[model samples]
Target: MKNSRSKPFVIGISGGSGSGKSTIINEIVERLGPEKIAVLHHDAYYRHRPELSFEERTIINFDHPDSLETKLLMKHLVQLISGEKVEVPIYDFPQHLRNSKTKKISPCQILIVDGILVLNDSQLCELMD
Candidate 1:
């Protein structure tokens, strides 16, 4: 479904590592107030590879777009746009796996998706406003 005018204005921020995506998002959040916007980090959606050891996971190139679970992120975005609550996955960067805990994200007036490869996914890009 398409996002309606009453729904949140979704913004996808895509850039390389240390490219100041967070800086930009943070600035917007500061001006808009934390309660006015919802932030989703793409790194938090990394695929859970529990079968691999920490060493093996460390060797994996997270820089690759495929390293993230883009599909799940897209699903969550859909739910958010539909005015539904979503349980966003929490990732353990040091362990290279998704943690059991999840963050409950509610619908907001503005949604900011911050990540390195957000624009690379056609479906996700199409869904963004």
Candidate 2:
């Protein structure tokens, strides 16, 4: 038996680089059906540094929590929980910048937020149930 409420059950998946976080997410989605879950990757919220050259951006330490726009991610999560549509930002890894387009995410029954720093943010932690 599972909870069938309107509000989603947010699952925070955190781990080190190359630690199989996406593998775990894939398994969850496979079992739960992708339609029932909305996946939000913290890496997608990486701070945009268009002013920097490709070489400079490539040299930046992406491991630091400061490298991500976590505040915006938190806001999107809050909005989703409130049953509102949110335009999730897309990061262009190769370009090292946020893409001009956003993924429009609708409210869902399960919101799975995955990233190395997902659980590190106090506000984000409070919002997950």
Candidate 1 on 31-103: residue-level lDDT in tens? Answer: 8888878988999998899999888999998888779889999899999999999999999887788899999
lDDT of 2: 0.91
Worst 10 residues of 2 by lDDT: 1-10
lDDT of 1: 0.90
lDDT of 2 by residue, 3-116 (tens): 577788888999998999999999988998888889889999999998999999998899898999999999999899998999999999988999999999988789999999
> What RMSD, rounded to one decimal, does every model reach?
3.1, 1.2
What TM-score would every model get versus the actual structure?
A: 0.94, 0.94
Model 2 stretches with alpha carbons more than 4 Å out: none
Q: What lDDT does candidate 1 reach at residue 45?
A: 92
In model 1, where is the ten-residue run with the lowest total lDDT? Answer: 1-10
